[model samples]
Target: MYPADLVKPMREELSVVGFKELHTSTEVDQAIKQKGTTLVVVNSVCGCAAANARPGARMSLDNEKTPDHLVTVFAGVDKDATDTARNHMVPFPPSSPSMALFKDGELVHMLERHHIEGRPADMIAQNLKQAYEQYC
Candidate 1:
């Protein structure tokens, strides 16, 4: 493991939520570019991440219809990879604890930080399940 001092909590938040780590820019691109629907979760260490986004994502994943691949880019921790991943999400500003659902290399659904902060986890999960139904 890399130093826990930097990236552990960020990783655990997503891991516990069932998201796979995509540590390299190449891995991020590969997951985004590969076949089938993919959910790119921009995981973060913010309170919103812990309180709403991560738990919500975990619940959504329990639904029968989920994305083919669940991947995460940890903001601040994976700076360049996160920046590169954000590039693929054009027109949206960078937001920690955001969620982006992609289909066949194109962005389809995006949940920004403002959409996540202070919301109920179930609400967030509902939105995610809707995105999964539509795109995944």
Candidate 2:
């Protein structure tokens, strides 16, 4: 795991953008169950995540009908939480720097790592924005 000090900045960046950190299995389950609309960001300790996915998710909130709940699970640092989150996201394969949009506890949309990697932030954001309007 990366040092807390190193991850603090990333955590804060997402938190300030209204993304809640799901640090426990209970938290992950609670965040996704019986919800209106939720966005699950599977965060990664990678340059592409820093430059693309996280920023993309942040910017996506500009659209109308944005998720009522926004949560995250860190891939390596928060292994248990991430794994638990992945379990909740059954049928969807594991992918860091990915996102899942759920409506009323059903997975509605997904953006995987390959989709997020090397993309321009705005482009990624735009894709998320579209999904937000359609599903959130």
Candidate 3:
């Protein structure tokens, strides 16, 4: 696991935007299962996460259409939580530094790591805003 000290600011990048940190499988399950729109961020300690994912996620919330809940689970630091979050994203492969939007307990939009790594933050935010407009 990455040191908590090292990832504190990274975690804060999302938490500062109102994302609750889900540290256990149960927490992930309960958080995502709620009614209304929920945004789950499978956060990670990677370059692209710092460069794009977190920034994009933060920017995306600026949109008028936003999820009712925002939460996150660290990929390596919270293994069970990450796995539980992935289970909600069935048919989609598990990815670090990903984003999943669930509405009424069903997965609606997913932004995998491949989509985040090479993209600019504004582009990623645009993608998320589009999803939000359609679903949230």
Which prediction has the highest TM-score against the true structure? 3
Top-lDDT structure, candidate number: 3
TM-score ranking from best to worst?
Answer: 3, 2, 1
Better of 1 and 3 by lDDT: 3
Error of 1 at 61 (Å): 0.6
Candidate 1 vs candidate 2: which has greater lDDT? 2
- Model 3, position 85: C-alpha lDDT score: 97
Q: After TM-score superposition, what is the CA distance of residue 121 in candidate 1 from its true location, in Å?
A: 0.9
* lDDT (Cα, tens digit) per residue for candidate 2, span 37-112: 9999998889889999989998888886689999998888888899988887778789898998888888888888
lDDT of every model, 2 decimals:
0.86, 0.87, 0.94
Off by over 4 Å in 2: none
TM-score of candidate 1 versus the correct structure, residues matched by position:
0.92
Query: Each model's TM-score?
Result: 0.92, 0.94, 0.98
lDDT of each residue in 30-79, candidate 3, tens digit only: 99999999999999999999999999999999989999999999998999
RMSD per candidate (Å) reads 2.2, 1.1, 0.6
Error of 1 at 25 (Å): 1.3
Runs in model 1 with CA error above 4 Å? 1-3
